[model samples]
Target: MIDTHAHLDFSQYDTDREQVIEECRRNGVQFIINIGVDFQTSKASVDLAEKYDFIYASVGYHPHDAKAMTDSIFEEIAQLATHPKVVAIGEIGLDYYRDMSPRDIQKAAFIRQLQLAERLKKPVVLHIRQAMEPAFEILRRHPGNYGVLHAFPGNAKEAAEGVRMGYLIAFGGPITYPNSQGPQVAASLSLSKIVTETDCPYLTPQQFRGKRNRPDYVRFVIDKLTELFPRYSRDDIVRITSKNAARLFNLPVDDSPELAYMIGKSLYLNLTSRCTNNCYFCPRNSGFHVAGHNLRLNQEPQEKDILTAVERYSGYNEIVFCGIGEPTLRADLMISLAAELKSKKLPIRLNTNGQGNLIAKADLPSKMRGLIDFVSISLNAQDETTYVKICRPQFGAKVFPEILKFAKDCKEYGIVTIFSVVDVPEIDIDACKKIADKMGIPLRIREYASD
Candidate 1:
């Protein structure tokens, strides 16, 4: 597994740095990202990356160093990022825990680095501690392509927010400690939005407490992760998180047929491009892409056209009811078409806004009983206020209550329910979890699509 985060640039590893790298290699640790906290360490990080194949570097000034940062420093960071192995531009963001740097300086430096990452087209490795709400404010205002929250400190509520923003949360050693409440919150999140990190020489897991951390201890993090998240295998964790890291950092990956990812081989029937909500951050307006696939819909396809598309990929894994618009808006045609696919014994997956039950004003979940193998619903917010601001639903607050009811209905019908929330900056993830847990269904927090 990749230790996507580490700070070998610190003096903590000065005595036996080479030995540490050797040990990491022996332990099957594929990669280690040595993050920089300032200009000097950032350069050292880049230098170390150049000397070793397995070690990559992330160049940025930490919040504590923000007070000393200047415009020239950003230029230097941009230049250092030109190094081939430099993967990100952070260890940036706020740290209310120390407040060593002035809040104003921290914010300015953080925003500057964010702009640098955007200009460099690189992902950031965030380090927010006891400042999620304010950190989120900066994030919402300067929503770039993507980044990760290294050692996230908020509850499931914050995790959901980060996930909605298309950011991955990197869990370090503290997760193994029995008393670490922050790590506990992270463990409860979906594996898709999580990546394991050692954050070596700091935040050591329980076993290595009071001892200097090492890259080899990544296994402990994975082992604990497996114990917490039983649905995922060790290999699955490596695959998913690595892929997410690769995507966020824009690392070139092997795209062989065996490695290429697709939700299913099924036909994805395009319904409509029009949406009821005009979310401020919706890709439909800013950038129309999903999973790197272009999703620019010019004209709506007729039912016959959709059926023809389905017939073309009939040997697929399944037929998915999905599109940029609400699939249920064409509910009549969808039910009829789904029935046709069912007759052919084709599996079906429905991606809906979950307003179908309220829109049709009927028992929609039961209507999907045998027609769908899985139903993925968008549970975008924790409360109605944020929901209105983020989703901007045409139906207003009505959509929020209706979606929750829809989740419960889907569970009762024995349909595989996926309750998805977006990574908007302000939503409460823990509250959403309470709702999902009460209803007894799986949850997915979607990353915000970027331009």
Candidate 2:
């Protein structure tokens, strides 16, 4: 996993830098982001990153060291950032713990570096302390996608603002300690809004307290994370946080086309791996990849977690109910959630099997009339026999009639209904379109994926 924030450039690593690197590699730590608190440290960080392939760096003046920042410092930082290994602009923000640098200087330096990060198109790793008000003000003033509040200690409202500004909240080793409120809150956030880091040489977990924290200790942080979020597997957290780190830092992540991707902003959910029907050409079973986004949700996330995900993405273009499982299975929850989102005027869409009515044993379209803006249903087969053969639905002969009737019902209810037929060899495309036309609804052809 990407460290995202660390202080290997500090004197703590002078004696065992090489050993640290080796241990990091052995413990499955992919990258260590060496951060700088001043010009000298920033330069040192860049030098270490240049020397070690697995090490990256961030260059900025920490609030505590803001006293040393000058106009010339910016030029030096700009020059150092040219290094490919330089990923971000901080470890920069207010730290009222010491207030070593005067408040004025700290604000000046922080704002300057914020502009620097924006100009460089790089993320900033923040070190906000008790100055949440001003720190948040500066962050909101410069809204960009590349930033994270490292070792985040803000309240839920502040965290919401950070996410709205497109920042990930990273939790470090302190999260593993018994009395650490910062990391505890961070761990409870949606997995999509969280990233894991060691913040090595500092903020060590309880077991490693007063000792130099290392990259291997990242697992301890993850342990605390699992204990807190509990919704995600340790592996899922690793993969997801690694991807988030890679995206924000512009590191090379696996760009395989097998993944599903969203163009702009949208709230996403990864519901389930299990499906009621085994459609021969459906990607739901093989692995539902959303372009570069993986939708193989390991477990059913709690409604609270789902709502958190929705809240984290409320600033998006829309919140879509396209998850690995049929959204209808969680119909009651989805409908209730849709009403909440409706209160916020958030657009909502449902990617379904077109059997919500059958599953709920009621009129779903009318039930969801004002709550859902769009309904996309899979109409993989035109007739009962083809439906049974292709979909292998649990409902057998009843599936085809139920789906067609549901699609028609959705259309009649004035909902934007889309009937989709997977492009499989055995499934007649023209027949599916004819069925859609007969129902007076729009038709779509979905790609037949392995699962």
Candidate 3:
């Protein structure tokens, strides 16, 4: 895991700083970005980065100390930011909650630092607190800047707005607190735009609350993320968050494609990227990434190649024939793989857009009976017109009734069938739920992500 925000250079770590960093290395922390809140801390952060290869630095003046910032200090910060080890210009922006610095002085410092970051071509680590409106106003004035909303204090809507503006939403220890809005916001946004941090020597995780925070405790943050995103495994969280930090800080990290990826305890197979419908709400519309796994395949895998991929994993609760694309496009391969996987004594599930029978020109549901244990069909809209408008099926509006018929056939064939709909504005979730109810199937409402 990567701790995107930390202040290990502070006095709290003066006694056992080296020991804490060692603990981070032992705890699987691949990288840590030490943040600079003022001139002294910024230089210290750079020194820490120089001392350790895994540690990077972000040099900037915190809003609380904005009043002390002068032209000379700003020039020093600009020069410090040029260091190869300095990855960003951050720990900056407005902080009205503390009111430690005059609001006007804070805004000026924030803008000056933002301009510096923009000129340096580095992402900014925003520190907005109870000043989101003004902070967003400044961000709007400077449209091209992109970075993270560190230790985000805003609601999901505000977080969504930041994401729309090309900034990532960062979560820290406060997310682990009971009755906090962190989980709600985390669940609302896509994991692709989320990154984890510890904000060491400050907001500690619930398990370690009332004590000083450390970079190694980032695992607790990852644990909270796992709970919020049950579809992704702990390792998946590490991989994805590390990738996000690496991208923002331009750190060297491995990010490879996966043919079979696990979510929760289920292993999902990516047999093909070919699909029958082009759903506007689909993540593929924006990118091929889902839960951090790139589902865009250069070549469709055969039965042997899939089995080889599956052999690398173990302890999965079930096998799911699902990817960014429609698995049913490779109906024969899916069935053959399911049959092969039956010996593993694990249940199998198929996530589809309910166009299998139409594509195969056969009773695909009946064909799946006994081989596929559960099926999740996409019931995106309540009626044919809505389906055509949102799904854009290759077979057009005529394919809508056939999708309903397909769900019915799955149930008739004794498969545990479920319907799913993305909660996009174009979709009437209640109406879709009613359709699922009438069909006697459960409806899963997926949160829509504009990113």
The number of the candidate with the highest TM-score is 3
Cα lDDT tens digits for candidate 2, 1-451: 6677778777788998888888888888887788888889999999888888888899888899899887888789878877788999988899887999999889999888888888888888899888898888877777763588898887777876777678888888877777777764674455667777888788888887999988778878767766665545566567767776776788777744211223245565544555668876665654464333666665676667666665544346666786666778778877877887687676778888887877888888888887888888998887889888988987778888888788788877878898887778878999888888877788988654231
Q: Per-residue lDDT tens digits of candidate 1, residues 248-326?
A: 6655554321111233344566677667777776667744543333345666667777766555443356677776677
Give the alpha carbon lDDT tens digit for every residue of 55-82 in model 3.
9999999999999999999999999999
Q: Which candidate number would show the highest lDDT if scored against the true structure?
A: 3
- Cα deviation in Å at residue 339, candidate 1? 27
Q: Between prediction 1 and prediction 3, which has the larger lDDT?
A: 3
Question: TM-score: which is higher, 1 or 2?
Answer: 2
TM-score per candidate, in order? Answer: 0.60, 0.62, 0.90
Q: What stretches of model 1 exceed 4 Å from their correct place?
A: 182-184, 252-255, 259-451
The best-first sequence of candidates by lDDT reads: 3, 1, 2
Error of 2 at 420 (Å): 19
**Comparing candidate 2 with candidate 3, which one achieves the higher lDDT?**
3
